[model samples]
Target: MGELARALTRHGIRVRVVAAHSPGLPVYGKIGDIEIVRPRYWWPERLEMLRREVGGLPVVWRKYPLARVQILSFFLMHAFVTARYAQSCDVVHAQWTLSAGAACLGRWVHRCPVLVTVYGSDILQVPRHPIGAWLTWLVLSCCDRITAVSHALQKRVVQLGVSPERVLVVPIGVDVTKFLPADDVHRENLILFVGSLIERKGVRYLLEAMPQILSVFPEYRLVIAGDGPEIISLKQRAVELGISRQVDFVGFQSQDNVRVLMQRARVVVLPSLEEGMGAVLVEAMACGTPVVASRVDGIQDVVTEEVGVLVSPANPMELAEGIRTVLFDPIRWREYSYNARLRAVKYYNWDIIVPRFIQIYQSLVG
Candidate 1:
């Protein structure tokens, strides 16, 4: 959403981000031309723990059961604020289903088109439950247009009874200039994994594959960036596998650091059990780094035989083999790197994606 806001502002579109408040962050601020307003959902501010995790409501409901009460306040406050802001906006563009639910309320105040973007679990996992299915259907049905991050998601949305004509696949774009290849920097014998340390990310399987990856390329090391609930267990698993020396858990990284890591690493890997579209894979590709990711929904839409290897998810052996294919062979790695950069520039760059968004907004407003 940050990228989208900046891109829209660059094109002279006024963007105001209204979201649930988080601790330590100001209730209102601005990043360049983008206005950010984080509405407070819960009272006694410290009790506001709903938006703390990477997975949002689902994770909060499953892990911190007591924190689920905040959902009521979150929904009420989010909808109220969204409706307040809707009066000034031309279009209400919500990023996820939950956000769309709130944005839909804005129609009561200002009769404008609401665009719902389904990224992942909101359309995939949430709809599996009876109550969630009803809510997801209600939210999606109420929206004027829907955008999905991948073709896989578009098919799923159509399956859920949305019209095919209303759905379009517009992936989250990456800044090619910020994450481009550093030809002057020497590539190291490092395998990079950048994402939350969550179970769905399959980081443990990456750890499980490291020993095998080390057996062949002893000098190679694995760098795990990002932090989450799975950190302690993942570290323990790495220690148990006796590959602790070869794996570096560099907690969380800023965007600049991630770009540098992608540029320097020989192969970037994301062995996710499922993905919305694997923005990390596109970022790696933008850095001219070949990827070795899982062959799962959304991920397959990005990775192909030319730019990267896609192995079965959750299988350490297959992950190891995929990494070895990129690490051990120089010619194959170079070919993958070249194609990866070309594909990223052609398809995933922000330069190419922002215009599509402008068209969508124009169509609705016109």
Candidate 2:
């Protein structure tokens, strides 16, 4: 979203980001030309823990049952602020399905078109619950257009009875210039994993596979970045596997730090059980780093045989083999490194993607 706002502003479009309030960030501020408004959803401000984690509200709700009270307030304030801004904007673009439900309310005030972009969970996981399905349907029914991050997500939206014409696949863009290969261009004996340490991310499987991966490449180390609910258990599992020394849990990383890591790492791995589209994979590829990810959902769309290796989702042995295949083979690794950069620039670069979004906005506005 920060990238999108910056890109939009560069193209002479004014952008205002209205988001859920966080603890330290100011309620109103400016990042360059972009306006940011974070509406407060809960009272006694310290109790505002709804938007803290990677999983957002669902994770908070499950961990602290009392936080459920803030859900209603979040929706109300979100809708009110959205409508407040909607009165001035040319169009309203919401990033998630639940947020779109609130953004849609702005249509009642401004009568402007609303477009919601589904990342992954909103269409895939949310609809599994009975009430969630009804709410999702209501949200979809209210939007003028829908944009999915991947074709897999688009198919899921279509399954929910949204018209194919109403939905388009527009992935989040990456700044390729900033995420470049190291100037020295020396790849290290490091395997990198970046994302929330969640069960669905399949990080445990990566931990399980590390023992086998280390036996062959003892010099190599697995660097797990990003923290989540599974961090503690994942650390314990690493100890049990006796590959604790071979793995380093770096917790969350800033984008600049991740870029530097990606540039140096021999391979960036994302062993996700499910994904809308692996944004991290694209970023790694941009850094001329080959990937070893699961052969599931939109990951397949990003990783190709020319760029990297793909293995079965939950199988540790296959993942180990996949990692070894890229690690040991000098010719394949070099080819993957070269092709990875080309593929990322051609498909996922912000230069290529942001224009597509501008087109979408023009089509709707016209």
Candidate 3:
């Protein structure tokens, strides 16, 4: 969302981001020239209500009800807020499909054009629920222009009945200056994985491959950065496989820290079963880290032979072999590292991607 907002702002569009359910009191801030309006709920009272409602339900039931209630509440609140603020803008650009619903309401009340972008989960994952499917369809149908992160996602939206012409594929861009190749001496024996520890993310496969990875390269270490419910399970798996000593779970790290880790790592791995556009892959490539990822839609788009290796998903032996192929061979590794940064600069840099979005926005507003 930040990336898109930044891109639109670069085109001389005045962007004001209004976020719902963000922590703390409402903040009006700036990232570069873009204005961000993050409004926090009055927590003590809201927390009390949430506690009462959430305390009794089983875990699975609790998630659905809580999520539904939150979405409805956010839509209501955002409608009120955006209707007022949206008056000054020509178009109300929503970052997500749910946000598109809010923007649609605001657009009707304010008579503004509504544009929405559907990242992977909003269409692929969220719409699995009956209510979610209906709401998603409504938002997709109502929006003036719909943007997707990949061609695969564009097709998915079309299947959802959004017009083929309405869907645009505008991938997120990377910041080249902030993420560049580290000094050769600084890169070490670290194998980094940066993302949530979830089943869909294939962290489990990475864990399963560790025994093979460590057997051949015992000196190398696997660094898992990010947090989720699966953290404890992944830790247990490491222990069960007797490769706990070779693994390091570093929870969540800031973008700077993630960039540093990417720069230092010998290789980056993301074995996701599905992805919209693996933003982290572009980030790692920008830092000259060769990636070994599954040949899923988004991963395939990012990991070309020049940049990194793509292997079959859910296969530990194949994943391990790919990682070893990169780590063991210095000539191939250095070539990929150079190519990764080059690819990031050429294709994934903000300079190139931001403008494409600007042209889209301009065409819509004009």
Worst 10 residues of 3 by lDDT: 48-57
Cα deviation of 331, candidate 1, in Å: 1.3
Tens digit of per-residue lDDT, candidate 2, span 85-203: 78888788898986798988767896778888898877878899888888898899889889988889989888888889999999877888888877534778999999998888999
Note the Cα lDDT for every prediction shown.
0.89, 0.88, 0.81
Comparing 1 and 2 by lDDT, which wins? 1
Off by over 4 Å in 3: 7-11, 25-32, 40-64
Q: What is the lDDT of residue 63 in candidate 3?
A: 48
lDDT of 1 by residue, 135-210 (tens): 8888999998999999989988888888899999999889897888878357998999999888899999999999
Return the TM-score for candidate 3, rounded to 2 decimals. 0.92
User: TM per model?
Assistant: 0.98, 0.97, 0.92
- Taking the tens digit of each residue's C-alpha lDDT, what string does model 3 give over 65-124? 554355456567777777878888777878888678887887767778888877677777
TM-score of 2: 0.97
Worst 10 residues of 1 by lDDT: 51-60
lDDT of 3 at 292: 95
Q: What is the C-alpha RMSD of each candidate to the true structure, in Å?
A: 1.1, 1.2, 3.5
